[model samples]
Target chain A: MNFNTDFTPLTVDPDKIYDYSFSIIEEEMGEHSFTDDQWKVVRRVIHASADFELGRSVMFTPDAIEAGIQSILAGRHVIADVQMIESGSGRKRFQKHGGDLHCYIADPDVAKEAKEQNTTRAIISMQKAVRENEGGIYAIGNAPTALLELIRLIKEGVAKPDLIIGMPVGFVSAAESKAELAKLEGIPFITNVGRKGGSTVTVAALNAISILADERAKK
Target chain B: MNFNTDFTPLTVDPDKIYDYSFSIIEEEMGEHSFTDDQWKVVRRVIHASADFELGRSVMFTPDAIEAGIQSILAGRHVIADVQMIESGSGRKRFQKHGGDLHCYIADPDVAKEAKEQNTTRAIISMQKAVRENEGGIYAIGNAPTALLELIRLIKEGVAKPDLIIGMPVGFVSAAESKAELAKLEGIPFITNVGRKGGSTVTVAALNAISILADERAKK
Candidate 1:
């Protein structure tokens, strides 16, 4: 069985994580609600680690997971599937969350597969996913070129998204990559200040939104 | 009385608080010895408070003073100065610090006079000092236009300095301003990673260089 199939049981945790993450999505629509502790967790994950397994294990608290889910429900889009396999290679994996919000877990080896027949199919799938879900935030965790292509497509009117959050957590190209995302003007977006921002910060912002939503629901 | 002359004789601790708040200087060559505590004191003064009086109160240990003096003795250049002032329309003040890296405090109400007459003369005098001190670092703290002029002079082969450290530590126009300094290729330079850098980081780098020089001298 492939890693995806072998890890099928683990997907339940990630699903729960997602549900928990986006639990307060509605509250994040009005304003940002990240506390200092949440910011610290987000910062740590984004700056130091790139592996989702490691980031998932260490950074994702129950609160963080729920907050992430809330963000999606509140019209924020979150994508966290692309993984770095090498300097310039990646893979795309598809996961169904059964929600209006589109999510994909691109293969960790997609970059290597970019030269293969499956590359076109993957890109097309992503494009379709984005197009099918318009007027919502698009959160890409660590896909630079892919995110860039997505943004270009959206800008060209091939697809439309309300917001694009580039939350790639790495050195060298990370800051430059986010700067490139910020250059796209039509959609409102938020990023960590300079190199300090990472996946953790991205999730923190979402978590803050979720917390706000939960509080509102309580009221 | 001349600003320097009038202020120099005042029975005040040269290390005590004065009118200049936080100041960041990037010295390419200098040997200043500072205790860990002293370094901490300097860092805190520059990072937290924007009051010049607090800056004036900062007293470097004998080692720190000597370290700074040694940088001048060696063949290195000081490229930037970042500081805060409370009295002027511009809350921040960045100027070229001559070998005489001392603060001249004037009455808050006399800011216009200081800007029009005293500060102008000080800048001119500092520039002259840079010319006279053949082996000393010519400091250029957060003056973007002046930094551009300096770059132009260097490129034209008029002013050949050993190194330039760009240490502007504020949010306003920092990215563009640093880009100007960083654009100078083929020159050995050190700067903070990004916005997190300020006077403290710049000076920290200088202090590190100073310690290295001191170790060499002991050899």
Candidate 2:
């Protein structure tokens, strides 16, 4: 059924926080496209997946999104617009950096457009972002379906991201999505503790990546 | 920041889904509230936190919500309600079961009354659902902040609920909210598997609980 019908702002219950989990998972699986030992200094992140199935609410903390973007910038990964399902408080955080921040949404007006065309639009956008910014970080948030399609495009030589970061912040699809990325033979994925991560952990993953990169750079 | 400014539907790039992680985490630190630990079951679930955040054009799935309620009916604890926040879909699901559901935007009219009353009407309604349905499962898909508060009220004798579930499906406040519920000493929590979970995993957790209960019954 159409999940999007009546919408409203959400009321938060702070005391209920204990019910969630804060688990992160990181893996170094074989690359999907890159060689086993190619060793590419990666910097680009994308947050392209389906929006939450529920109503709209401010889920991510600005600090978390900022941390993710900051890591890419510090690593000299030109920050591509965080490819999200839509824009909200999180987008504002990225826009503050004064860079090209593109918001990719499934335009209802273009619902008739072929899925391939929509994918191509997104791929072209990513390709442009990477081409314009050398050594830039292309980051995508935790949208597994979108990421997978993008990966297919990349493997097909339509788009190329230096590094792919998988940071989907929920319990249902996070693991499977990450696994999909892990299956990509060459790219290194930096992910969260999993399940109860939310925005804080998403940002934390970026922080971890930045720290790891710093350590590597020092050597 | 007023997070509820642009209330629109979010979209999904089917191709970009791979960019997200989909794994589950199983932590063994917490205490189980049920006497029949053998009856308990768990699974990880995930979903988009907001419809507008991703853009508009995605469909909703009631499988997660239905699964949670069914599990509780079958006797199991649910960790998350991945789609509770989608007012329209949530309400429709509730109605299908002969339940009454309502959605409020918290505009000036409702917000003023809500503030003056020192309570949210929605929480009250949800609490009523829990209290009225003894030995039955009731789930809330929004953030736990308000639900937790309602639970505290119930604990204080101001409200009552036989069972209450929290499953806000996003990376933003999901973990923090669930963590709050987990902290409650007596309440049993069945959460998602890290960032990978969504509505699918939340239902799985409930199924796990039911299976455990079934196993114990046989013994």
Candidate 3:
């Protein structure tokens, strides 16, 4: 699958914002370093974020791309670290595939647990997400604490995820968490190198994968 | 009201993420240009978003900071262009000051109107927001079209707002809309120079002003 063939803009804008963004990003990226599927995500990320830094920051384990797509194709769960990520994800794409998009940070129970535990609500949200869907695709966009908790749970043999898209933004643990994610052996993850990530970047990757799955299925 | 006076670390952690981020940004932003209150907003914007692009991009009319603080102090409404901005904004701060935050992008009524009018839902959301709260603080984070529409309404005297925080993040009209904002002579606003703004940046500004108001009131 070539980069251009794998995905198309879903909107009806005559200006083709996504289309022109793709072309410009490809020009700046210069070389074809990523696989076609992986490029699909990277292109959409720079397109969505308008930051060419992602071209250098985006790190993907070999199987991470395929894992996200397969999960999307199968209509698996996408559990986000925060409501912002869940809100920014590709809505119509998920609707078409019957995707289960969830973010528990706003749940009354999660808030209660966080207050009782003296921990961040994001940590409680991750614990609840892993408890509900062990093999689901996880997207962490807002909280480094959540990503760190997810890593700890996976190490303790507590839960497993099909894929992890870790793009938490903040100076506190944001860069360190991505470095930790890069070191993990078999989690199959997509992450960046530094503190330059947010829910928008996380959702861009998700929206890209969902778009890929949507177009691929049509064929 | 120096840069270092108005804000201290909010959390207990000794490793101050916001503090260090502020120092680095000050170094990057060489000369002190903004007013003390204005610098508070700019510092927090760079803190929340680790992009120095905002230093050059952030645009504020002379009285925008004091205007936003005054509106927040008075418990005016805050209408956002997207849910992500609405969700990421510090909620308790608003409640403490009796501020009302709203986003109608996903509302069924907005959806119905968008379908009926053949326009984007964000335009309809802005229309509804100005109709409901004539002196509200308008926060636009994810859509240039929404910002453009808001500017149009204000230009046409169809709507009025206390302040406009326009930071839509994309390539299309992001820069143009901000340029438009700078042209509005009397409309108090906080905007940026380019496409390097989003829900995070928009909420960061809102959060900064709210925090300033909250702390200033405590004194």
Scored by TM-score, the top model is 3
Index of the highest-DockQ prediction:
3
Q: DockQ of all candidates, in order?
A: 0.01, 0.07, 0.38
Tens digit of per-residue lDDT, candidate 1, span B22-52:
2221121123453654544344333332212
Q: Which stretches of candidate 2 lie over 4 Å from their true place?
A: A1-89, A95-106, A109-143, A160-163, A168-189, A192-219, B1-148, B160-163, B167-219
List the candidates' TM-scores in order: 0.30, 0.38, 0.87
The whole-model lDDT of each prediction reads 0.39, 0.36, 0.79
Q: Where does the lowest 10-residue lDDT sum fall in candidate 1 chain A?
A: A86-95
> For residues A1-219, what per-residue lDDT tens digits would candidate 1 score against the true structure?
122343323222323323322332222223434454444344333222222222232222234434444444564444432321110011111112222333443334443444453343234435655655645545554444446567668778876555455554332234455676667665555554333333323443444444444455467
Q: How does model 1 score by TM-score?
A: 0.30
The deviation in Å at residue A36 for candidate 3 is 2.1
With a 3 Å backbone cut-off (N, CA, C), the pairs that clash in candidate 3 are: none
lDDT, candidate 2, residue B196?
A: 26
User: Predictions ranked by DockQ, top down?
Assistant: 3, 2, 1
